[model samples]
Target: MDGEYHPKSEATVSVYDHGFLYGDGVFEGIRAYNGTVFRLKEHIRRLYEGIKVTRINLQLTKEQMTNAIVDTLRKNNLTDAYIRVIVSRGRGNLGLDPRSCPKPSVVIMAEPVAPAHGKEAREKGITAIISGYRRDRVDGTSHELKSLN
Candidate 1:
């Protein structure tokens, strides 16, 4: 069967999915221009790095994942869109145990983005402010890992 053309109902995950359990996962947001996915190599590299750091086992070759992304886009007939690639801890018990979660879930979603005010925003200079909230120190959460807490 052609997985890329399947409906959303056909692409389902178990409720026991560990990503929902322990927030044990990493993801990348990528963009495609024309018909090419940009920075795909970098995105995959970071995903693997996160998996390694989190001790999650994943079996897909990078090429396979890349092809999947492209295939999905092609199936949908979309040339310019955003792609979200996620590798999540697979299904396991209710308890917070990484050992129970042996496999990792890989998902890639592609969709179009509304146009941003590109040059206008840059030329006019967008305004911003530091919110009252302060980000936690990187050391506190091993921010370098780039994985969800």
Candidate 2:
């Protein structure tokens, strides 16, 4: 998706993009309230921290990234919604080398969501969704980094 905005149906990334090819990326789930993004600065700070550790070279400053997210919410005319911000190592070779990627890909998405739970759970129970992603801990020790990869 890069820096430009597009309809979700038309959004895409190259097959060779490291994020797509190897799941090399980081993401944050955010929320908005009444036309204002919640804790946007904190989220941007944390996202940059992850970028620091991952060395993904997002090519956009934290401010730029934050603006993108806010703009996405506005574009969709969404409030009280769940937001997802993703940054990935851009197009690269089929090999495992990070050097192959130069620019990185970025995507921001938002949608209305169900409540976090409580009354809904008491009444209708809950549904669980399983993911194909597998996460492994080092020697059963937890890491501070939460990631999509």
Candidate 3:
């Protein structure tokens, strides 16, 4: 598997990683079109905003993160792809203190994407199911933050 991409064997975080314990992190999903990354700037902007809202300190500049995504796509010889960007609270002890988590974990992954639906579905419209779960109040979770959990 010399040229093949391999998943990380073990993903680890510190005992105090807020993201690991409290789900205090944000993420973004992006898509690339042809050989160009679509809406990349907007995606990064949103990520920055999310970080600011969540108070997660990302070490990399937006430009660096974007370049990393593009580099991965090029390395894999992929044109149409999906990208996942995440910022997590750095490792720390089991305390509810932000100062303990000094450095933040930044991860970017890019991979090819294939949609399941065909043109017929797009033209005819698709059926959707309503979920029983209710969305969190904007005031409580600040709908703007795209963090999981």
Candidate 4:
């Protein structure tokens, strides 16, 4: 998961990853339209902000991350697609403390997806339900930060 592109079948991550073990990570959902990534800069900014909130030292800069996303799309030959970027606290011991994790893992995946509700929903809006639960207001776990949690 560390900057390498792999088929969905082959991609894997360590069980010790803080993200997997403790939801210690951040991610951004992005979209590409007509070969152009939409609001990529803004997404990158949000990602960095999340990293800041979580105190994760992502090795890549904002520019590098942006290039990686574009590169992933190009590699997959995807013009219009859904892209998800995840940066996770790397492998560590079973302990809950994050300091045991020395590095972070980065992953960029792109795939095509159709609208869940189909075109009819776009033409005539469908009914919906909203969750009553709200995220807690803790500093490291704030909903605004966007994390694996």
Residue lDDT tens for model 4, 20-119: 9999999999999879999999899999999998899888989989999999999899988999999998899999988899999898889986556677
Pairs of residues at least 3 apart in sequence or in different chains that clash in candidate 4: none
For candidate 2, what is the TM-score? 0.78
Deviation (Å) of 112 in candidate 3: 2.0
Question: Relative to the true structure, how large is the alpha-carbon lDDT of every model?
Answer: 0.76, 0.81, 0.75, 0.88
Q: Which stretches of candidate 2 lie over 4 Å from their true place?
A: 114-144
Off by over 4 Å in 4: 115-143
Alpha carbon RMSD to native, model 1:
3.6
| Whole-model lDDT, model 1 | 0.76
What TM value does model 1 have? 0.75
- Count of residue pairs whose backbone atoms collide, per candidate: 0, 0, 0, 0
TM-score of each: 0.75, 0.78, 0.73, 0.81
The true-versus-predicted C-alpha distance at residue 126 of model 3, in Å, is 8.2
User: Candidate 1's residue-wise lDDT over 42-125, tens digit each?
Assistant: 877877788888888787877887788888888878788998777888888998878888777877777876545577896898
lDDT of 1 at 88: 83
Q: List the residue pairs that clash in candidate 2.
A: none
Q: Which predicted model would earn the best TM-score?
A: 4
**Residue 54 displacement in candidate 1 (angstroms):** 0.6
